[model samples]
Target: MRHRVGPRHARRPAPTLLRGIYLPRSMDAGAHAMTTFGIPLLVLATTNSAVLTGVAFALEWVPRLAAFALAGAMVDRYGASPVFRTASVLRALTVVAAALALPYSDGVGATVTVMLLAASTGVLSEFSYIAAETAGGAASRAAGSRAHRVQSVLLGIDQVGTLAGPALAGLLLERYGATGMLTVIAGFSLLAGLLAPRQRDGRAAGLPEPVMKGLRTGWSTMRSLPTLCWLVVGLTLSNLAVGLLQAAAPVIVIQHMGRSSADVGMIWSVAAVATLVAVALWRRAIDRYGLWPVGAVAAAIAATTCLAVTLTHTYTTYLVLIAVLMAAEGGMTVMLRTLRSHLIPASAFGSTLALSALILLAPFPVAGVLIAVTPPALLVHVMTGCAVLQAVGLAVTFARLRAAPGLRTALA
Candidate 1:
């Protein structure tokens, strides 16, 4: 059933190439962007409620958080690439199921069921996402001096997807409604699934450890590194602030600004451009100026931009400021990701990154809860306080990290 190639004919190593498995992973991210952005609009359209929209947004993340430990264990025990393939198929199936349920989405019960089902898909998608990212990190490392450059390319691909996906979703939802848009998302998921298994990372091998054994190894790895542990804590706090933007941005853009879903699309499209520019400049800036200095400056910029969000009620200001704020966040994201790649051993990449991600993202739902309860007028002030807190925290933490004896040698 199988044909063997002669010595004269050999296949190129796609996994060692610049694009590699990261390309499909980026496409999958786009599918994620589509569903995540579409969910709030879909819920708001059906229920005519901002609170429900926030709840729907929160649902997407909750199950993913719940599944992180297991997802990591699975990826580590069985290999990241295969886990990614399985997750992609599951994502495609769920997207199809959710698409089929669209007609009944008008009722509260139906909407709730659909939202929860979407969350289940999110759980699987997160597994695939982590696997892809871990593989991407490996590919970039293999690329040598151009590692950051290759990573920038990958990040650009992801941003392109993130940018186009929501806008396309918005356009599709407006033109054809939820069913048509969901169909598109399902197609993306399916395509990602099909493409994933073609590329294999020689580096993504599984340990012989059982799930709990793997988890304990990852935990030990995380705890043994003081700076990495600090990074997880600091980044998690930073995400608490980021959670506000994620949960409330849609409400602000649509409900408060009196804008359409198309406006949300435009906002992120601009942000995507900003993200590309930021990623391009960030590594070079870090090389010249040092990571701590550049990160501090980025943190200051992000803090200033976020706090500025409270200064005006204008839709244009919110769009521009949020886009700029996200740009700064994008740079910081790459910086942190680089650190993770450098710090975590390849054997523990899946599990450690999973635990780290769980810690970082848990605040999103909390932000959703706050958005539901906090008065709209006071929301801006709360976000401003969070931004200020994050900025100050970043400054203090980075300073301490740099000053710590042996930290530089260890990182080196």
Candidate 2:
């Protein structure tokens, strides 16, 4: 008979590789599937006019800002896993509804209304994403790096989907028309919903406290910590800068370069590839050096890269600039996510994390408006300035954190 023994007196326990590393990758795939279907559905269902499309797109962000706070509180009350599963299913159902509505819309007015409804429903998925990250906990911050590594990997995959979804939608639309495309989207949504149940067994049994209690607890906890407060503030500013840059990228490519759709796709693909590589490298670096220095370096690099974008005119030069900028952004993102995982207690995890997301996302509409109103030259200038500000803010925050013994130890 084979004998299995516990660690003997003279021996140590075997080192085990963490399984949580795979969890982020899986969650990321699920996120990619969700976004892939959601974005195309908006595109496929909308009128071809840029103005109408912009209006529909703008509606999507509206609910995201409005509902984020409540979603965070509810996530704490219900627990991340359960909330994630429920929202996934709800999002799938909403997509299915959008699929149904697509066939009926005859013109811009009808299409806009249906697309607006679709975008509104899609916001729920964002809530579920925040919850999933919260559930990741310290496993999210394993090896001194944060969820950013996982986020970057997943985001890379998501970008692939972003690249693929439109092409797939176009093919499907050509083959099966609007109805056929919607059917394909519905299938993706169903897959996403099915994936949710696998997150954690028995997650439903541990219902959190009431929403009010959870909010109060989260508020108290956040208010008590100076590090958490400043971190959120800095991240919020960073995200605002990111949002503006993102909204402006396509506009710059289209207007400045007079690029066709294919060229635009190529530019984005290059940026995505760069982000993926930077993130993978940043993850390794963070595991070795820790988040503070990695983040500081990333911020500085991002600032320079953003400024470089304004100077580039040729397609190759612009692509190179974008790739470099995205790399830096990807690195900073990983560090910030890791820091967020560290700062919050497990019990208040979802709410606190969600609050940070809410704050960070608060300026998206403003960024979008800036994209709409400002001249391309002015917008690019503003984005470069913002990137510089983000670098300075992150540096200052890092300095404050390094000086404070409690915060420094926590970060380390």
Best lDDT among the predictions, by candidate number: 1
- In order, candidate lDDTs are 0.74, 0.60
For candidate 1, what's the RMSD?
A: 3.4
TM-score against truth, every candidate: 0.90, 0.76
Residue 295, candidate 2: how far off, in angstroms?
Answer: 0.7
lDDT of 2 by residue, 315-370 (tens): 88977887787778777677666666667777667667666676777766666566
Residue pair clashes in candidate 2: 146-338, 148-334
Give the lowest summed-lDDT range of ten residues in model 2. Answer: 13-22
lDDT of 1: 0.74
